[model samples]
Target: MKDKVKGLVVGVLLGSLLTGATAFAGTNTKISVVMENVKMMFNGVHKSTTQSIVYNGNLYVPAKTAAQTMGESFTYDGKTKTASFGAKTGTFKYLDEVSYARIDGKTNRLYFKNWTNPEGLKFTIAGQKYLHGIGVILDEPYSYDDQTISIDYNLNGGYKKLTANIGIDDYTRNSTNSGSLIVKGDGVELYRKDDMKGGDMPESINVDVTGVLKLKIVFEATLDNGRQIDIVLGDAKLIK
Candidate 1:
């Protein structure tokens, strides 16, 4: 009886191994995988010539190709892991084992902490928080403080016009401060504003830069009295 039981167990094990081998052999058949091509269009025009790919159930497209489709210049630095557009730049870093790209520049709407002022006295963003993405806040702890904030851009003879939206932060309900917003090219002032109060609507400014080299958007502020004041360049952009 023992020998018969041992024989049945061995036979069962052999049958299972044979079945697995047959399944493995069936998988050896050649199967074609079809990849779908993606088209990226801007203004009703096709942008990509290279096909996008799907990996791990995620669609992946070439960064450079995608940017080119939208008529924006794109460059990558492998050594520094940095990517740059015409006048904008961003860095790629790993955080929590996940990679992220952070762009360094100002846009139409910006948070106080995200504003970049390379040419100005050291300042901080302080005071009651407002939840609108309209402009930048300068100098925290509202007191008598003077500072300048600026945004720099490189034209390379592409854009012909530049526009800026200037205003005082709406959150500063009641404060006393004076400031000026100035646009300069090649160290020459093109436009300046010295009169703006808190809770005031932003003003639109336009300038011709057909033959200028470097463009700078500057905001200068001085504490008049009462509490520290805030000024903002609500929006700035170039147009062809």
Candidate 2:
């Protein structure tokens, strides 16, 4: 079955490539093209299709078919004659690109990057360094009190996924540092990790944010032998 499916072919078109090869058939453009059956596959999996073509040595298929095959959404508007694809897929928007509604329960910090410095935060975890994402010190030096940082985003129900690499920065990797990470969507907890240490590998976070209007991430650190650490959310972004 796999062999037969792998050989499945769609139509392909090939023809002349002359400079004056400009014409129209009915309301659509017409050109000298050869139609053939071509098989398509991705990652050893067959991508079944009924209509496809080869034009100028390139394969062409319906935009909707291609997009859908890649797990993306596609839409067309007849009245406007417009097409839309990949609204909540195959698109990533950095969290820093937009303004947040609050930080640690205060709206005064409209600038999100201030928590990590203007140049952006860099942190090392698992022998690797990551750059340009939200990072903040969770605990104060010599302070026995527990500290927490909460960054909130007003998603406006537009995004579908949230992704980030979470970990403690190497600045305190050698110290007795520990913390908890929590992610919330619309006042509901979506993910949580307790007792994370600075020496641990970065935790890759990829959570569903569908229909989420308000997104919140909280990092809380406990006092351990007067040690401090930078809890980093590296390369954090929202997909829509």
Which predicted model would earn the best lDDT? 2
122-165, model 2: which lDDT tens digit per residue? 45676666654676675666654437778888888899998888
Q: What tens digits encode model 1's per-residue C-alpha lDDT throughout 1-240? A: 222223211100111222111222245763333244677665567756555444346554556665566566666666866655444412211111221122123333233322344432222223223222124444446433325556555655555666545677545635676667777776788887886677565667778767767766666656534454556543344656
CA shift of 71, model 1, Å: 32
Top-scoring candidate (TM-score)? 2
Q: For residue 20, what is the lDDT in candidate 2?
A: 37
| TM-score between model 1 and native | 0.42
Q: Local distance difference test, per candidate?
A: 0.49, 0.67
RMSD vs true structure, all candidates: 19.5, 9.0
What is the alpha-carbon lDDT of model 1 when measured against the actual structure?
A: 0.49
What TM-score, computed on C-alpha atoms, does each candidate reach?
0.42, 0.57
